[model samples]
Target chain A: MMVDQFVAQIRRLGHGVIDAVMRLGFAARFFMALILASGTGLRRFSLVVREIYFAGFMSLIIISVSGLFVGMVLGLQGYNTLQRFGSESALGVLVALSLLRELGPVVAALLFASRAGTAMTAEIGLMKSTEQLVAMDMMAVNPLARVIAPKFWAGVLSMPLLAAIFSAVGIFGGYLIGVRFIGVDAGTFWSQMQAQVSVRTDILYGVYKSFVFGVVVTAIALFEGFDAPATAEGVSRATTRTVVISSLAILVLDFVLTAFMLGGN
Target chain B: MERSTYDLWVGLFVVAGLVALLALAFKAGNLGASSIGSSYVVKANFDDVGGLKVRAPVKASGVVVGRVTSIRFDPVRYQAQVTMKIGDAYRFPRDTTASILTSGLLGDQYVGLDAGGDSVMLKNGDTIHLTQSAIVIEKLIGQFLFNKASGGGKSPSSSTAKAGGL
Candidate 1:
């Protein structure tokens, strides 16, 4: 009986692996469909604009607020630590580098995944459950072109910009705490940051990271929703999966990108 | 929301993002004051460069005049060859001395140029003579430790004089 149970468990595990691989393959094909159908989506630019408004503008308040708080915390913590080493002036360098290189892209993407990504999954999943996608197919209207491609493009366009805004606000918050409140030399703070941070390496790399995250997060969210079972429970589960899977993907991609970008120097 | 309203908001969002990117580039990065344009390159050789890295600011009397463009090791001379690009806005004499200096005790290293009294300005491709290598802190500390261990039996004043020579 024990041997039989062990064999059954092994089979179950293999089944799970196969299921995941099949889902991943399906997602890839869906992504390729999105790209191919993007021409039609772009032709009706209003759809993309509406999606951008929802995905980008709607999330701005939370991103800015969280960015400010994160920066203020970084400033406070960095000041206390750097003061011990008598390098309080270098606080600007620390704050800017951390925010621009790591925190901005990663945190903003995480926020985007939770807020915008979940909404994308839920909306699409609901439409799928209601047979809207099938209805569109019956009418010879491709939902991939009409619905999914627009959302995907909006995500790809908005993420880097959102991440930029987050970093910029975070830097201001750091300046407020470090220079204005803590009395670190204002000149040294700005000058040192400018001197240390290269536009190409630090800022451009951050933008590139966000762009990749946008594509990944949007793809996963849409894929989960589109592939979700036609039930309320399935849509809800897919929404949750969008958040969990995208967050994990963001972090793993961040590590790989950072190593690839900075390992040379 | 109406279609027009969506378009307006999207427009505003894109503009805001662009503005933020510009602020980051100008304020927090070296975009506004980058001196890589129309620059003249000069080479300097050092026995040791320590922590001096490529793209480090090359300052003349505390003002940044150029950047270190490249650092290469010369197997022939067993020295580090540093190429610096100086902005054409500033001119330094041919006899200028390039010495690597640190900002604070633990700060990043930079090349300091002390212009010598020379009538001729340094042109592109000129090798700067009288270059001082970066002070390796480990060697200094090790020497100090070695001095103390060796001179433990001698008078303390003698060791003090020897240490001062460094």
Candidate 2:
């Protein structure tokens, strides 16, 4: 009986892995369909514009405020460390590099996932539970093209822009702390940063990372919402899942992208 | 919001994002501003590059005049060959010495040009013959410890003196 139970547990674990793989496959197909349907959806440019405002504009305040705080903290920490070595002038380089290279994209993506991504998931999941999706299907309208495609594109386009704003605000915050407060030479702060950070290497790659993150986060949120069981509890669970899954995915993908983009450099 | 109002706001948002990106590229990344002015290329050979990287500033008298464009290994001499692009407005003497220098006790490395009293100015494709490699801290510390051990507990300054003599 013990031997049989052991076999049963092993079989259950195997089935669990297979189930996850199938779900992943389904998600991939769903994402591809959304992408293909987006061209048709693009004709309704108004819908996309509205979605962009909802996702991008709505998140600007949080992105800017968080960016400023993060940058100020970096400046404070960088100043304290560099002061010990009499290299306080390098504060600009420290702050700019930290923001452009790592913190900017990762932090902004996390914020986007939590704020915009969870909202998208909940909205779509509620629509599913309320049978609005069924109504659309019965009316012979493609829900993928009408509903998901615009949101998918909007999220994808907003990410890089949000990341840029974050980095820019963060730099300004650093300048305030490092130069205005700590008395590091203003010229040195700007010049050192200009000399060190590369447009292609640091900034563009960061934008690219955010772009990928945007697509991943939006896709996950939409997929979870679409797959959610048509119940109130299911919609709530899906919203929570969107946040948790997108956050984990962002961190994991950040590591992979960093290894590929920055390891050699 | 009305369609036109929404469009205007979205347009403003995109413009702001682009402006921020441009600021980052120009102010921080030093993008197209480099190529906007005329510049010339000069090469220098170093025994070691240490932490020197492409785009590291090439400074003269603590003022940036150019940037390191590329670095490659010279297999024949087993030295690192660094190519720099100096802006045309700030010409240096032909006999200028280029050295890899750290900005502080622990900081990024940059190419520092010490202009010599030569009458002729360096032009494009000119090679900087006098070049010093980066000072590796680990090698210096190892040398110091070796001297101290061999000197049988001598003062640190004395050990430095003996090491300098070696």
> Chain B, model 1, TM-score against the native?
0.85
Report how far off residue B152 is in candidate 2 (Å): 16
Per-residue lDDT of A82-161 in model 2, one digit per residue for the tens?
Answer: 88877787899999999998899999999999999989998899899899988998999989999999999889988899
* Candidate 2 whole-model C-alpha lDDT, 0 to 1: 0.89
Cα deviation at A57, candidate 2, in Å, is: 0.5
Q: Give the per-residue lDDT digits (tens) of candidate 1, residues A1-265.
A: 9999999999999999999899889888998988999999999999999999999999999999999989999999999999999889899999999999999999999999999999999999999999999999899999999999999999999999999999999999999999999999999899999989999999999999999999999999999899899999999999999999999999999999999999854
lDDT of 2 at A125: 91
* lDDT (Cα atoms) of all candidates against the true structure: 0.93, 0.89
Candidate 2, which CAPRI tier?
medium
